[model samples]
Target: MASSQPNMERFLREWRQDALNKAQYESAIFIGDKLLAMTNDDNDAFFLAQVHFAAGNYTRAQALLAKQDLLTSNPSCRYLAAHCLIKQNNFVEALAILGEHTPTHLFATNAKRKTTRGVRAATARANSKTSSRHHDQGDDIPEEDILNRRYEASMCYLRGLCYAKQNAFDRAKEAYKDALRIDVQCFEAFSQLVKNSLMSPDEEDEFMQSLAFNSIRAPGDDPDMEDEPADYVQMLYQTQLSKYHNPQAFNTAIESLSTHYGLENNADILLAKADLLYTQCRFKDALAITESILMDDKYNFAVYPIHLACLYELRKTNVLFLIAHELADTHPDEPCTWLAVGVYYFTTGKIADARRYFSKASMMDANFGPAWIGFAHTFAAEGEHDQAVTAYSTAARLFTGTHLPQVFLGMQNHAMNNMTAAEEFLKTAYSLCKTDPLLLNEMGIVLYHQDRLKEAVKMFASALKIAAETDSDPHAWLGARTNLGHALRRLRKYDEALEEFDQVLRDGGKDAQIFCAKGLIYLDKERPEEAVQVLHEALAIHPQDPIATELLNKALEESAEAGDIGLLGTADAAFGGETSEEGGMSGDLASFEQRLGEKKFAARMKLARGRRTAAEMPGQSGGVKDKGKGVARSGRRGAVGGTRLFRGDQEGVDSMELSD
Candidate 1:
């Protein structure tokens, strides 16, 4: 029956494989359980536990392991049981099983080692004091010293494990090396040392040899102990407490760990400290801790991601580049490192380089949203609007809830001079996120351009209200104010427009549009000179400005016309005084003769002249007139240079007629 068991196991394995391949997890678990019952072997039991674990039947797996008493016979079964207990948050029991059974397993061992080390240290110290008087005795001294030294070395190895678990690879490697210095034959310490050292330098052969030697020892040669130290419980409690976000709890954990184990040797405590600083937005301090880990040659690949994140948070882009370059050079197969490099490039405005790195990231993992977004932004920068839209659309489709792609799409259409389409996309974006002041402001600007003045005013007003209420952004408020001023100006509400422009100026808005609007108000008030001065000032700030140039010409022409009218008024006053000296007839006859002489000369020359000349020049009598009026008078008909200066209404005769 035992001989045929192998055949039965193979048949069951084939059946389970078929069930799994066919997406029949329930059938797979049923077959695996039967195999477990028939064989009661370590391999079959482990497989059965896996099927149950996969199928979310962790309770059944725990019961099966407990019934078989396979926890001792199989280290893997112990690990699986502990994993299930951890999932169930039976951490104390999980810690015990993990500490006792898998003393050198990376994940479970690291998880429990800090607590275990404290317990062992207290026990050793207690034993040492009890035997203190025999310390100087020859045989006993050496033996006791060796035991204490081994305990100390083991404690250091445990510290390394704690550090490794928290992603502090450098501190972990240091602790492991310290353990090895005290006890070179310490397999756990040597194993971690080899693992961490191989992370930076390619020493695969040496790492394999170290692993081979570490696993060669027997259970009896290094017997597992059960007397846990007091400090272990305290450290375990602190680790559990660190998961909460309470600052006081983190502080308590840090102080306790540092006081008991020393901060330099406590990598878990250091990681907790870094996390606390990160929560406080003290990214620089977090970056310093992460950088210390990367500098160590023994740092693990898992820690690289955390280190990258810390550098990114601090915006230490240059250092991130160097780290990424090193990671790419050594770990070319890993896509995350290359993806990080692409993100850095994209943020720094190196669009083409960003696209290349993003392409590399895409090749590694095509579904990476960030890489796709970076690729899209690069195309947008290069003015490939259609391609950019497609890339952003693809990224949005993959990650449905993100707003970044929609924002980019609106910006692209706005840049392409498609204002209507831009407004449509931005309205959808506003519906999705109404509190976004930027989207509101952009939509308002589009409406302003489309000449929907009332709608534009409402939009800008809404943006302003939201910005004020939320303290959203000062710049957004400034933009809305500027747009509001423009809309008011178009409506010819010059006073209200000036008030808005003044508000923007007070708000530190030195933009050219604000100045231009203020100039327009001056122009509307018939104060062209003032308008010219303001427009010129704007031009000085922004040379070759088109609006300023146009306004300046109108101002100069109006000034010239006003100057000519003042000169004509002075000429009339001088001629009036000279003609008043004679009697009314002589003055009028002389003026008429002067006007007639001037008219005959002008008619022969056919000269085009001012209205003043037409009114004052001599007419048919060929004499100057001093008619007691400024130039032409009541009941008088006069033509100068064949042009009639006075109509019948001006002549004061009922129907006076003039001849040329």
Candidate 2:
């Protein structure tokens, strides 16, 4: 009968494990109970508790596993019990279970303790070893000690989660650090620190480099792990963190994942690759990968948010609107569904509606960073700086892993003329990730405003380089080149500035701002004829472009001063100004320019201060704010109140679904 009992226990243990793997918690619980009833062993009771924990029966799990004898003997028991308490929102009790001094085990009661079978041998062997490692271990540990350390690390991870939930981020960062240092495989704890941007870029890199990943040997990563490289798990963990920085390293890690581990076709790896592309601003290429993924597995929610973002970036409005409706009808509860709806409203210039839908998406999942960004853009579009800052601040706090929130915050502060604050925020973001295209461009603008012309020039050059590398559309990054030109012009490098301007124009630059900038450089170089030519072209493209008209008038005055004649009719005709029956400009050049300047002063003031009129609000994007040929797109995170589409009414969004 005893012999039969051993076989029965073995069968039940295997059965319990199978149930756990399959998430058949009822089966796990039933098998766990049978094993406990059969042996009345502490390990069996712990197994039962684990089953209960897996099934969300926290109270039962805690009561069974938190026995003083078991908890005192096994770190796993203490961690599991504390984890159960944490789940029940009993943080105090959970912390008590974890202990104040980082104790590996906790004793709830000092009553006569009966050690579990085999624990005595395990504990003794654990005590005798001198640990060896890739780096200094300080002391040796036996096999049992290694398991205890992993469980103890889990204890720190739970503490971090508890602290984070309470908004005690500083304390949470330390706890997460401890968890990661103790067990590099504690990915959740590391992810929390990374995703929350809890650490500075330097801190993250320093800590990551310091970890003893090479020396650490998980139980599963022993010599028996013949299928993988000895350092495969550690390499994979490294790939998982620090995703916001170091593209070269990321590519190498991905290559290793594909070739070394033969995970080329792995879904998770593909998703990582796609996310990397997105971070590099290769949205179109990223979208292609995500689209292929969804075609094979349609319910891939992980790919959905990024897919929506790519569509928005590419200004695929009709496609986005159709997807929004399809997602709303089919996956109504999904955060991505509402985010798609929000993006659609955003692209169409319905700022208020976009904000509402974004809020709904956030309500569905508060961790949805894109929703928060969209919500903030709604405010930014309407020129609501304070509210936008508040929204962006929340996103910055929530999604520390991405530099995007800080980028927007910096730009918004720049818009408000808080150059000091803008620089601080932009620099902070730069430290975290120095390579984002838009981020560099915006930072360059801030530097330009601060009169740090050389710094701004470098920033713009770097931005152009990065954008040019990944940008499929030659016209995509003309703004960066424009900014470069402006910086060069400020530095009186007229020839270099003009070259940049010429490149922008060659790429089909249509923004009047670019033309005005190009014209200004010519004026700076004392070439009034060239200035007049460019400004006239700018006004021809945008008949009522105030900046172009203002610049053109100055250029015309200079040209007339240079002994030019009969230029009035040609200039007026080209610029589409009011002309007399004789087809001549009205009044003298001085009086005409004076009156024109006074008439457009309010608009120029708005332009000079970088403020948008109600009609030029951000979300009013045509084709998701393609900048309307002559209009410069707002540098805000998403389109602010751009109420009009870039295209005419003929390009109306349709309800037709996308072709599979």
Candidate 3:
């Protein structure tokens, strides 16, 4: 039986790999059950538990493991049990189980020892020029050591996942490092580490260089030429880390991975690269990859959603409908399929259809955060503010770590003129996702409206700093620069403001709004001719802009009256002139008539000031009459180049025409 153990294990391993194949689940489970019944061996339970776990029967897997003393039995039982708990979001229980069974300090020490041993083995193997057996022995880890390392790495990886879910990023980073140290090929740990912001670029490059070069180490060859196919999963992680920040580097990594592991052999890496392309808005490239994957595996549910998303974004309606129908027919019961369709509808501005599909997905799985967010988005689109707020609140609660819900909530509240509520939500969103410049821009807008000029300037400046640091999102960078110019202008910092506006123009921001801001600055400086030139440029782009038209009128008037003696009348007309129905102006005219002399102009101005003061007294009929006229005139056209609504990247919000 002891000699037969190796053969039995090899057969079991082969069978297990086949059984876990998603397409072969039912047949494999039936055969596994049959084998379990025929075997009286101590390992029968573990094998059966693996079958159940792979078949998505988490409870059954846990029950089988519960029958054994998991601490003394194969460590795999505890690892699998913890995985089941994590899948169900029972993270607290999973963490407790990991803490009880795993020794952190001991594992750390063992990891260092393993690294030392590998180095020593390599040196010894190199020294033995006569023996190939030495090389073979040097590369092999003892079975017990292999099991220990596997157990420790799995435990630490799961621990990292739990911490990440709770938004404890610092702890998550430490946990990922521990897992990588224990098992050098732990691709999951490497992927999560890159996903987090804890690693600086220099540190990430160093780590990535080491992983990519050592991905495959051969007996006696240069590290670069050609190495064995060590897992390409780590390469996927490297591409993920640089996917947005450095697309050239990401493409290079992906090409290398594809070359090492042929595209046909590594579907997950292909899908990952395709997803990265999709995120970078390279929809055509992503669609090509997804199409290729579909040709080989039509029922690959994961690839179908991505294919549809690419199709929708690319406006490939003919293919999009075909794929959507196929996906619905193939995976009708899967909530994610419904969620994907809903998100597609949402993206396309079909709110009614989006809501219907989102609701269906929510009914299928109440915990699905994207479906709930989709539902909230529909409510927001329809201007049902209260309902939208409620739905967004639910989404925020469900997906605590994601910034989308809070960002949308802040935008919605800000749109509705609820500045206090908007700022609160934006602050929470900033806390959740500090690196997003868009959130900072929104916060700055809120502060700008609240009359906190200094605070708004700081917010915009901070957003600009982050945008420059990231250097990937051009829209965020340009928008923040524009907002910074506006903030500086409000603070009366003309020189700094002009520099910002000029920088934006140099960076290809030939926007009508930027021109209007610059023109306003010239108007404030009384440089009417310069103002006229700038305003004409703004009007050429946006003729209906009310504020630009008003400023242009003022500039024209100032230019015409370049040396006018009727400055008093011009000033009075510019600042709310007297209404013909009111008697205040008649009283002022009578006083001016009474002061006729050589110094009549100066004396009439003094008497006009007294009459104006008398007319503006509290509770006076003249004041009441003036207030009524001002209120009546100040209607829809009152907001002259006033605060712009915070329209995020979403479409349809800027539909209102800019007019008086």
Question: What is each predicted model's overall lDDT from 0 to 1?
Answer: 0.49, 0.62, 0.55
- The local lDDT score (0 to 100) that residue 275 gets in candidate 2 is 61
**TM-score to native of every candidate shown:** 0.40, 0.76, 0.60
| Prediction-by-prediction clash tally | 20, 20, 0
Query: How do the residues 291-410 of candidate 3 rate in per-residue lDDT, one tens digit apiece?
Result: 888788877754644565556455565665565566688788986577557655655667689789879977895544445655766776555667878987875654444454676688
lDDT of 1 at 31: 94
Off by over 4 Å in 2: 1-4, 11-24, 67-69, 103-141, 216-230, 242-244, 329-333, 399-402, 451-455, 465-474, 523-526, 549-601, 604-660
Q: Against the true structure, whose lDDT is highest?
A: 2
Q: Give the candidate order by descending lDDT.
A: 2, 3, 1
lDDT of 2 by residue, 122-205 (tens): 113234334332323522567777777788788888988777767676788888878877776677887666545565545656
| Alpha-carbon runs more than 4 Å astray in model 3 | 1-39, 52-72, 78-102, 109-141, 148-236, 241-325, 362-372, 384-406, 416-434, 452-478, 493-515, 537-543, 563-660
- Estimate the overall C-alpha local distance difference test score of candidate 1: 0.49
Candidate 1 C-alpha lDDT tens digits along 490-603: 665778878988887787777554575577566545555676787787787777765455556655554464466553223223233332211121232235434544654565
